[model samples]
Target chain A: DVKVTQSSRYLVKRTGEKVFLECVQDMDHENMFWYRQDPGLGLRLIYFSYDVKMKEKGDIPEGYSVSREKKERFSLILESASTNQTSMYLCASSFSGANQPQHFGDGTRLSIL
Target chain B: DQQVKQNSPSLSVQEGRISILNCDYTNSMFDYFLWYKKYPAEGPTFLISISSIKDKNEDGRFTVFLNKSAKHLSLHIVPSQPGDSAVYFCAAIRQGAQKLVFGQGTRLTINP
Candidate 1:
Protein backbone atom coordinates (compact mmCIF):
# COMPACT_ATOMS: atom_id res chain seq x y z
CA ASP A 1 0.00 0.00 0.00
CA VAL A 2 1.15 3.54 -0.74
CA LYS A 3 1.24 5.87 2.24
CA VAL A 4 1.94 9.59 2.56
CA THR A 5 2.51 11.03 6.02
CA GLN A 6 2.35 14.64 7.15
CA SER A 7 4.26 15.94 10.16
CA SER A 8 1.30 17.43 11.99
CA ARG A 9 -2.43 16.98 12.08
CA TYR A 10 -3.20 20.36 13.64
CA LEU A 11 -1.12 23.48 14.24
CA VAL A 12 -1.62 26.92 15.76
CA LYS A 13 0.85 29.66 15.11
CA ARG A 14 1.06 33.38 15.75
CA THR A 15 1.47 35.95 13.03
CA GLY A 16 5.02 36.42 11.73
CA GLU A 17 6.03 33.00 13.05
CA LYS A 18 7.95 30.66 10.81
CA VAL A 19 6.12 27.44 10.18
CA PHE A 20 7.20 24.19 8.61
CA LEU A 21 5.07 21.33 7.37
CA GLU A 22 6.74 18.07 6.54
CA CYS A 23 5.58 15.27 4.26
CA VAL A 24 6.95 11.84 3.50
CA GLN A 25 5.85 9.24 1.02
CA ASP A 26 6.82 5.58 1.11
CA MET A 27 6.08 4.73 -2.53
CA ASP A 28 9.22 6.33 -3.92
CA HIS A 29 7.19 8.51 -6.25
CA GLU A 30 9.04 11.15 -8.23
CA ASN A 31 6.48 13.95 -7.90
CA MET A 32 5.50 15.69 -4.66
CA PHE A 33 3.01 18.54 -4.32
CA TRP A 34 1.80 20.98 -1.65
CA TYR A 35 -1.69 22.41 -1.66
CA ARG A 36 -3.92 24.50 0.58
CA GLN A 37 -7.61 23.60 0.72
CA ASP A 38 -10.22 26.14 1.68
CA PRO A 39 -13.93 25.75 2.33
CA GLY A 40 -15.22 26.72 -1.10
CA LEU A 41 -11.94 27.05 -2.99
CA GLY A 42 -11.15 23.34 -3.25
CA LEU A 43 -7.46 22.57 -3.46
CA ARG A 44 -5.04 25.26 -4.56
CA LEU A 45 -1.52 24.17 -5.36
CA ILE A 46 1.24 26.06 -3.56
CA TYR A 47 4.28 24.19 -4.82
CA PHE A 48 5.34 20.97 -6.45
CA SER A 49 8.61 19.11 -6.78
CA TYR A 50 9.28 16.72 -9.61
CA ASP A 51 12.77 15.74 -8.50
CA VAL A 52 15.18 16.31 -5.69
CA LYS A 53 16.23 19.97 -5.42
CA MET A 54 13.77 20.90 -8.18
CA LYS A 55 10.63 22.89 -7.39
CA GLU A 56 7.94 24.79 -9.23
CA LYS A 57 5.52 27.40 -7.99
CA GLY A 58 1.88 26.53 -8.27
CA ASP A 59 -1.19 28.72 -8.43
CA ILE A 60 -0.97 30.23 -4.92
CA PRO A 61 2.70 30.27 -3.94
CA GLU A 62 3.02 33.77 -2.59
CA GLY A 63 3.59 33.05 1.13
CA TYR A 64 5.01 29.55 0.89
CA SER A 65 8.24 27.85 -0.12
CA VAL A 66 9.10 24.18 -0.48
CA SER A 67 12.12 21.94 -0.04
CA ARG A 68 12.79 18.56 -1.60
CA GLU A 69 16.19 17.55 -0.40
CA LYS A 70 15.42 13.83 -0.60
CA LYS A 71 13.20 11.64 -2.71
CA GLU A 72 11.08 10.40 0.19
CA ARG A 73 10.56 13.67 1.97
CA PHE A 74 9.17 17.07 0.96
CA SER A 75 8.80 20.13 3.12
CA LEU A 76 6.49 23.18 2.95
CA ILE A 77 7.73 26.37 4.54
CA LEU A 78 5.93 29.57 5.37
CA GLU A 79 8.33 32.52 5.38
CA SER A 80 6.16 34.58 7.69
CA ALA A 81 2.88 33.08 8.76
CA SER A 82 -0.10 35.34 8.44
CA THR A 83 -3.74 34.98 9.38
CA ASN A 84 -4.67 34.49 5.74
CA GLN A 85 -2.25 31.58 5.50
CA THR A 86 -4.39 29.47 7.79
CA SER A 87 -5.92 26.53 5.96
CA MET A 88 -5.84 22.79 5.57
CA TYR A 89 -2.51 21.92 3.99
CA LEU A 90 -2.28 18.76 1.93
CA CYS A 91 0.68 16.85 0.55
CA ALA A 92 0.45 14.52 -2.38
CA SER A 93 2.78 12.26 -4.37
CA SER A 94 2.46 10.56 -7.70
CA PHE A 95 4.63 8.60 -10.09
CA SER A 96 5.83 10.02 -13.41
CA GLY A 97 3.16 9.09 -15.88
CA ALA A 98 0.23 10.53 -17.78
CA ASN A 99 -2.52 8.48 -16.10
CA GLN A 100 -1.13 8.25 -12.60
CA PRO A 101 -3.30 8.99 -9.57
CA GLN A 102 -1.88 11.20 -6.82
CA HIS A 103 -1.64 9.60 -3.41
CA PHE A 104 -2.40 12.07 -0.63
CA GLY A 105 -1.67 12.44 3.04
CA ASP A 106 -4.20 13.03 5.81
CA GLY A 107 -3.36 16.76 5.83
CA THR A 108 -2.37 19.34 8.42
CA ARG A 109 -4.96 21.83 9.58
CA LEU A 110 -3.02 25.02 10.31
CA SER A 111 -4.48 28.01 12.10
CA ILE A 112 -2.71 31.35 12.30
CA LEU A 113 -3.60 33.63 15.18
CA ASP B 1 -12.21 31.23 -12.74
CA GLN B 2 -12.94 27.67 -11.71
CA GLN B 3 -12.02 25.34 -14.52
CA VAL B 4 -13.95 22.52 -12.84
CA LYS B 5 -17.25 23.00 -11.02
CA GLN B 6 -19.40 20.80 -8.85
CA ASN B 7 -22.33 23.10 -8.34
CA SER B 8 -24.34 20.81 -6.13
CA PRO B 9 -22.89 21.34 -2.68
CA SER B 10 -24.77 18.40 -1.18
CA LEU B 11 -27.03 15.50 -2.14
CA SER B 12 -29.15 13.01 -0.24
CA VAL B 13 -30.00 9.48 -1.35
CA GLN B 14 -31.68 6.47 0.19
CA GLU B 15 -29.76 3.29 0.66
CA GLY B 16 -29.78 0.82 -2.25
CA ARG B 17 -30.61 3.59 -4.67
CA ILE B 18 -28.41 5.00 -7.37
CA SER B 19 -26.67 8.26 -6.49
CA ILE B 20 -25.52 10.43 -9.32
CA LEU B 21 -22.94 13.18 -8.75
CA ASN B 22 -22.40 15.69 -11.49
CA CYS B 23 -19.43 17.85 -12.47
CA ASP B 24 -18.76 20.38 -15.19
CA TYR B 25 -15.61 21.89 -16.58
CA THR B 26 -14.93 24.94 -18.71
CA ASN B 27 -11.56 23.83 -20.02
CA SER B 28 -11.85 22.16 -23.40
CA MET B 29 -8.29 20.94 -23.35
CA PHE B 30 -8.85 18.63 -20.39
CA ASP B 31 -8.69 15.09 -21.69
CA TYR B 32 -8.40 13.12 -18.48
CA PHE B 33 -10.96 13.32 -15.66
CA LEU B 34 -10.81 11.77 -12.21
CA TRP B 35 -13.16 11.40 -9.24
CA TYR B 36 -12.07 11.32 -5.63
CA LYS B 37 -13.94 10.62 -2.38
CA LYS B 38 -12.99 12.29 0.87
CA TYR B 39 -14.17 11.79 4.42
CA PRO B 40 -13.97 14.52 7.01
CA ALA B 41 -10.44 15.17 8.30
CA GLU B 42 -8.95 12.65 5.85
CA GLY B 43 -7.47 13.16 2.43
CA PRO B 44 -9.31 12.44 -0.74
CA THR B 45 -9.11 8.93 -2.18
CA PHE B 46 -9.02 8.17 -5.89
CA LEU B 47 -12.30 6.65 -7.00
CA ILE B 48 -12.32 6.27 -10.77
CA SER B 49 -11.23 8.01 -13.94
CA ILE B 50 -12.02 8.18 -17.64
CA SER B 51 -10.05 9.28 -20.65
CA SER B 52 -11.27 11.39 -23.53
CA ILE B 53 -11.15 8.42 -25.87
CA LYS B 54 -13.72 6.62 -23.76
CA ASP B 55 -17.11 8.02 -22.81
CA LYS B 56 -17.74 5.61 -19.99
CA ASN B 57 -15.79 3.48 -17.53
CA GLU B 58 -17.05 1.15 -14.84
CA ASP B 59 -15.56 -0.69 -11.90
CA GLY B 60 -17.85 -2.75 -9.72
CA ARG B 61 -20.72 -0.54 -8.55
CA PHE B 62 -19.08 2.74 -9.57
CA THR B 63 -19.41 4.12 -13.09
CA VAL B 64 -18.05 7.32 -14.59
CA PHE B 65 -19.51 8.83 -17.73
CA LEU B 66 -18.12 11.67 -19.75
CA ASN B 67 -19.89 13.98 -22.17
CA LYS B 68 -17.29 15.81 -24.17
CA SER B 69 -19.68 18.01 -26.12
CA ALA B 70 -21.16 19.44 -22.92
CA LYS B 71 -17.89 19.43 -21.02
CA HIS B 72 -19.54 17.48 -18.24
CA LEU B 73 -19.07 14.26 -16.33
CA SER B 74 -20.98 12.21 -13.78
CA LEU B 75 -20.30 9.46 -11.32
CA HIS B 76 -23.01 6.89 -10.62
CA ILE B 77 -22.86 4.73 -7.55
CA VAL B 78 -25.29 1.86 -7.60
CA PRO B 79 -26.83 0.62 -4.39
CA SER B 80 -25.27 3.34 -2.33
CA GLN B 81 -24.65 2.48 1.30
CA PRO B 82 -24.18 4.59 4.38
CA GLY B 83 -20.47 4.01 4.04
CA ASP B 84 -20.60 5.66 0.65
CA SER B 85 -21.32 9.03 2.23
CA ALA B 86 -18.46 11.38 1.52
CA VAL B 87 -17.45 14.52 -0.32
CA TYR B 88 -16.73 13.87 -3.99
CA PHE B 89 -14.34 16.00 -5.99
CA CYS B 90 -13.91 16.01 -9.75
CA ALA B 91 -10.55 16.88 -11.24
CA ALA B 92 -9.27 17.35 -14.76
CA ILE B 93 -5.88 17.35 -16.42
CA ARG B 94 -4.79 18.31 -19.86
CA GLN B 95 -2.88 15.89 -22.02
CA GLY B 96 0.69 15.23 -20.88
CA ALA B 97 0.30 17.48 -17.85
CA GLN B 98 1.27 16.87 -14.23
CA LYS B 99 -1.15 19.23 -12.49
CA LEU B 100 -4.84 18.53 -11.86
CA VAL B 101 -7.49 21.22 -11.66
CA PHE B 102 -10.14 20.36 -9.06
CA GLY B 103 -13.76 21.21 -8.40
CA GLN B 104 -15.24 22.66 -5.27
CA GLY B 105 -16.67 19.21 -4.45
CA THR B 106 -20.14 17.83 -3.66
CA ARG B 107 -21.06 16.10 -0.43
CA LEU B 108 -23.04 12.88 -0.83
CA THR B 109 -25.13 11.53 1.99
CA ILE B 110 -26.60 8.05 1.91
CA ASN B 111 -29.46 7.43 4.29
CA PRO B 112 -30.35 4.07 5.67
Candidate 2:
Protein backbone atom coordinates (compact mmCIF):
# COMPACT_ATOMS: atom_id res chain seq x y z
CA ASP A 1 0.00 0.00 0.00
CA VAL A 2 1.18 3.51 -0.80
CA LYS A 3 1.56 5.78 2.19
CA VAL A 4 1.30 9.52 1.71
CA THR A 5 1.84 11.54 4.86
CA GLN A 6 1.12 15.20 5.42
CA SER A 7 2.96 17.05 8.15
CA SER A 8 -0.15 18.39 9.78
CA ARG A 9 -3.82 17.53 10.01
CA TYR A 10 -5.08 20.96 11.07
CA LEU A 11 -3.44 24.34 10.92
CA VAL A 12 -4.21 27.87 12.07
CA LYS A 13 -2.35 30.86 10.72
CA ARG A 14 -2.60 34.60 11.02
CA THR A 15 -3.04 36.92 8.06
CA GLY A 16 0.16 37.74 6.14
CA GLU A 17 2.00 34.82 7.74
CA LYS A 18 3.86 32.41 5.58
CA VAL A 19 2.40 28.92 5.84
CA PHE A 20 4.10 25.72 4.85
CA LEU A 21 2.43 22.37 4.27
CA GLU A 22 4.65 19.35 3.91
CA CYS A 23 3.97 16.01 2.27
CA VAL A 24 6.02 12.86 1.87
CA GLN A 25 5.31 9.63 0.06
CA ASP A 26 6.87 6.24 0.58
CA MET A 27 6.01 4.84 -2.85
CA ASP A 28 8.76 6.73 -4.67
CA HIS A 29 6.16 8.18 -7.03
CA GLU A 30 7.43 10.65 -9.60
CA ASN A 31 4.47 12.96 -9.45
CA MET A 32 3.28 15.03 -6.49
CA PHE A 33 0.31 17.35 -6.45
CA TRP A 34 -1.34 19.87 -4.17
CA TYR A 35 -5.04 20.66 -4.16
CA ARG A 36 -7.57 22.60 -2.14
CA GLN A 37 -11.16 21.56 -1.55
CA ASP A 38 -13.96 24.03 -1.01
CA PRO A 39 -17.66 23.72 -0.68
CA GLY A 40 -19.36 23.50 -4.12
CA LEU A 41 -15.89 23.62 -5.71
CA GLY A 42 -14.58 20.09 -5.49
CA LEU A 43 -10.84 19.71 -5.65
CA ARG A 44 -8.86 22.34 -7.55
CA LEU A 45 -5.22 21.76 -8.25
CA ILE A 46 -2.83 24.35 -6.91
CA TYR A 47 0.49 23.00 -8.11
CA PHE A 48 2.16 19.82 -9.29
CA SER A 49 5.64 18.46 -9.63
CA TYR A 50 6.54 15.83 -12.18
CA ASP A 51 10.24 15.69 -11.31
CA VAL A 52 12.62 16.94 -8.74
CA LYS A 53 13.06 20.72 -9.04
CA MET A 54 10.44 20.83 -11.77
CA LYS A 55 7.03 22.25 -11.00
CA GLU A 56 3.98 23.41 -12.93
CA LYS A 57 1.12 25.69 -12.04
CA GLY A 58 -2.32 24.14 -11.91
CA ASP A 59 -5.64 25.89 -12.46
CA ILE A 60 -5.42 28.03 -9.34
CA PRO A 61 -1.78 28.84 -8.53
CA GLU A 62 -2.04 32.37 -7.35
CA GLY A 63 -0.77 33.14 -3.81
CA TYR A 64 0.80 29.67 -3.60
CA SER A 65 4.03 27.94 -4.54
CA VAL A 66 5.48 24.43 -4.28
CA SER A 67 8.90 22.90 -3.74
CA ARG A 68 10.04 19.40 -4.54
CA GLU A 69 13.65 19.29 -3.51
CA LYS A 70 13.47 15.51 -3.15
CA LYS A 71 11.55 12.92 -5.09
CA GLU A 72 9.74 11.75 -1.99
CA ARG A 73 8.94 15.14 -0.53
CA PHE A 74 6.71 17.97 -1.72
CA SER A 75 5.92 21.17 0.05
CA LEU A 76 3.22 23.77 -0.48
CA ILE A 77 3.86 27.34 0.60
CA LEU A 78 1.42 30.13 1.12
CA GLU A 79 3.24 33.40 0.42
CA SER A 80 1.11 35.34 2.87
CA ALA A 81 -1.85 33.55 4.29
CA SER A 82 -5.14 35.35 3.94
CA THR A 83 -8.63 34.59 5.09
CA ASN A 84 -9.57 33.55 1.59
CA GLN A 85 -6.85 30.91 1.64
CA THR A 86 -8.55 28.89 4.32
CA SER A 87 -9.54 25.50 2.98
CA MET A 88 -8.78 21.80 3.23
CA TYR A 89 -5.39 21.20 1.60
CA LEU A 90 -4.67 17.80 0.18
CA CYS A 91 -1.48 16.22 -1.15
CA ALA A 92 -1.29 13.35 -3.56
CA SER A 93 1.44 11.25 -5.18
CA SER A 94 1.39 8.92 -8.14
CA PHE A 95 3.68 6.94 -10.37
CA SER A 96 4.83 8.55 -13.62
CA GLY A 97 1.81 7.83 -15.73
CA ALA A 98 -1.47 9.52 -16.42
CA ASN A 99 -3.37 6.31 -15.90
CA GLN A 100 -1.71 5.45 -12.62
CA PRO A 101 -3.82 5.92 -9.52
CA GLN A 102 -2.84 8.80 -7.27
CA HIS A 103 -2.70 8.10 -3.57
CA PHE A 104 -3.70 10.93 -1.25
CA GLY A 105 -2.88 11.77 2.34
CA ASP A 106 -5.31 12.76 5.03
CA GLY A 107 -5.96 16.44 4.29
CA THR A 108 -4.94 19.38 6.40
CA ARG A 109 -7.77 21.69 7.32
CA LEU A 110 -6.34 25.22 7.32
CA SER A 111 -7.83 28.24 8.96
CA ILE A 112 -6.59 31.78 8.42
CA LEU A 113 -7.52 34.57 10.74
CA ASP B 1 -15.57 27.53 -17.74
CA GLN B 2 -15.96 24.14 -16.07
CA GLN B 3 -14.83 21.32 -18.29
CA VAL B 4 -16.26 18.67 -15.98
CA LYS B 5 -19.70 18.82 -14.40
CA GLN B 6 -21.76 16.83 -11.90
CA ASN B 7 -25.28 18.13 -12.22
CA SER B 8 -26.54 16.49 -9.03
CA PRO B 9 -25.17 17.93 -5.82
CA SER B 10 -26.46 15.08 -3.68
CA LEU B 11 -28.26 11.78 -3.82
CA SER B 12 -30.14 9.63 -1.31
CA VAL B 13 -30.68 5.93 -1.64
CA GLN B 14 -31.91 3.11 0.55
CA GLU B 15 -29.40 0.67 1.91
CA GLY B 16 -28.78 -2.36 -0.33
CA ARG B 17 -30.14 -0.39 -3.33
CA ILE B 18 -28.14 0.67 -6.33
CA SER B 19 -26.50 4.06 -6.17
CA ILE B 20 -25.62 5.67 -9.47
CA LEU B 21 -23.64 8.90 -9.74
CA ASN B 22 -23.28 10.73 -13.02
CA CYS B 23 -20.58 12.95 -14.50
CA ASP B 24 -20.11 14.83 -17.76
CA TYR B 25 -17.15 16.38 -19.45
CA THR B 26 -16.78 18.86 -22.28
CA ASN B 27 -13.22 18.01 -23.22
CA SER B 28 -12.84 15.54 -26.03
CA MET B 29 -9.17 15.10 -25.22
CA PHE B 30 -9.95 13.20 -22.06
CA ASP B 31 -8.92 9.58 -22.48
CA TYR B 32 -9.51 8.28 -18.97
CA PHE B 33 -12.07 8.80 -16.24
CA LEU B 34 -11.96 7.99 -12.52
CA TRP B 35 -14.22 8.12 -9.50
CA TYR B 36 -12.99 9.06 -6.03
CA LYS B 37 -14.75 8.74 -2.70
CA LYS B 38 -14.09 11.23 0.09
CA TYR B 39 -15.08 11.43 3.71
CA PRO B 40 -15.18 14.45 5.98
CA ALA B 41 -11.70 15.82 6.80
CA GLU B 42 -10.06 13.17 4.66
CA GLY B 43 -8.61 13.27 1.18
CA PRO B 44 -10.42 11.57 -1.64
CA THR B 45 -9.61 7.93 -2.25
CA PHE B 46 -9.51 6.18 -5.62
CA LEU B 47 -12.62 4.11 -6.12
CA ILE B 48 -12.85 2.97 -9.73
CA SER B 49 -11.81 3.99 -13.23
CA ILE B 50 -12.46 3.21 -16.87
CA SER B 51 -10.59 3.90 -20.06
CA SER B 52 -12.30 5.97 -22.70
CA ILE B 53 -11.97 3.15 -25.20
CA LYS B 54 -13.88 0.77 -22.93
CA ASP B 55 -17.48 1.20 -21.93
CA LYS B 56 -17.45 -0.45 -18.54
CA ASN B 57 -15.18 -1.55 -15.72
CA GLU B 58 -16.14 -3.29 -12.52
CA ASP B 59 -14.39 -3.82 -9.20
CA GLY B 60 -16.14 -5.59 -6.37
CA ARG B 61 -19.32 -3.63 -5.73
CA PHE B 62 -18.29 -0.56 -7.73
CA THR B 63 -18.80 -0.32 -11.48
CA VAL B 64 -17.86 2.52 -13.77
CA PHE B 65 -19.56 3.05 -17.11
CA LEU B 66 -18.37 5.40 -19.80
CA ASN B 67 -20.07 6.70 -22.94
CA LYS B 68 -17.65 8.29 -25.37
CA SER B 69 -20.33 9.80 -27.56
CA ALA B 70 -21.99 11.63 -24.75
CA LYS B 71 -18.72 12.55 -23.01
CA HIS B 72 -20.24 11.19 -19.86
CA LEU B 73 -19.57 8.58 -17.19
CA SER B 74 -21.37 7.02 -14.27
CA LEU B 75 -20.49 4.99 -11.18
CA HIS B 76 -22.86 2.38 -9.86
CA ILE B 77 -22.51 0.87 -6.42
CA VAL B 78 -24.86 -1.99 -5.78
CA PRO B 79 -25.83 -3.26 -2.34
CA SER B 80 -25.01 0.14 -1.00
CA GLN B 81 -24.20 0.13 2.68
CA PRO B 82 -23.85 2.86 5.25
CA GLY B 83 -20.12 2.90 4.73
CA ASP B 84 -20.71 3.71 1.07
CA SER B 85 -21.99 7.14 1.96
CA ALA B 86 -19.53 9.84 1.05
CA VAL B 87 -18.75 12.61 -1.40
CA TYR B 88 -18.08 11.17 -4.85
CA PHE B 89 -15.99 13.04 -7.38
CA CYS B 90 -15.55 12.28 -11.05
CA ALA B 91 -12.25 13.13 -12.69
CA ALA B 92 -10.79 12.98 -16.18
CA ILE B 93 -7.32 13.06 -17.62
CA ARG B 94 -5.94 13.22 -21.11
CA GLN B 95 -3.11 10.99 -22.26
CA GLY B 96 0.25 12.41 -21.13
CA ALA B 97 -1.43 15.46 -19.59
CA GLN B 98 -0.91 14.22 -16.01
CA LYS B 99 -3.47 16.76 -14.86
CA LEU B 100 -6.84 15.54 -13.65
CA VAL B 101 -9.92 17.66 -14.18
CA PHE B 102 -12.50 17.10 -11.45
CA GLY B 103 -16.18 17.87 -11.32
CA GLN B 104 -18.13 19.27 -8.43
CA GLY B 105 -18.71 16.22 -6.24
CA THR B 106 -22.02 14.67 -5.37
CA ARG B 107 -22.67 13.72 -1.77
CA LEU B 108 -24.15 10.23 -1.43
CA THR B 109 -26.26 9.33 1.53
CA ILE B 110 -27.36 5.77 2.20
CA ASN B 111 -30.39 5.49 4.42
CA PRO B 112 -31.42 2.39 6.26
The residue-level lDDT of candidate 1 at A109 comes to: 99
TM-score of chain A of 2: 0.98
Tell me the TM-score for chain B of model 1: 0.99
- What do the candidate models score in CA lDDT, each in turn? 0.95, 0.95
Model 1 lDDT, full chain set: 0.95
Model-by-model DockQ, in order: 0.81, 0.82
Q: Give lDDT tens digits, candidate 1, residues B1-112.
A: 8899999999999999999999999999999999999999999999999999999999999999999999999999998999999999999999988999999989999999
Clashes of each: 0, 0
lDDT per residue for candidate 1 within A1-113, as digits (tens), equals 99999999999999999999999999999999998989888888899999999999999999899999999999999999999998999999999889889999999999999
Please identify model 1 stretches exceeding 4 Å from their true place: none
- Give candidate 1's error at residue B6 in angstroms: 0.6
lDDT of 2 by residue, B1-84 (tens): 899999999999999999999999999999999999999878899999999889999999999999999998999999899999
On DockQ, the candidate that comes out on top is: 2
Superposed model 2: Cα runs more than 4 Å off: none
The TM-score of predicted model 2 comes to 0.99
Candidate 2 structure quality by residue, lDDT tens digits, A13-34? 9999999999999998999999
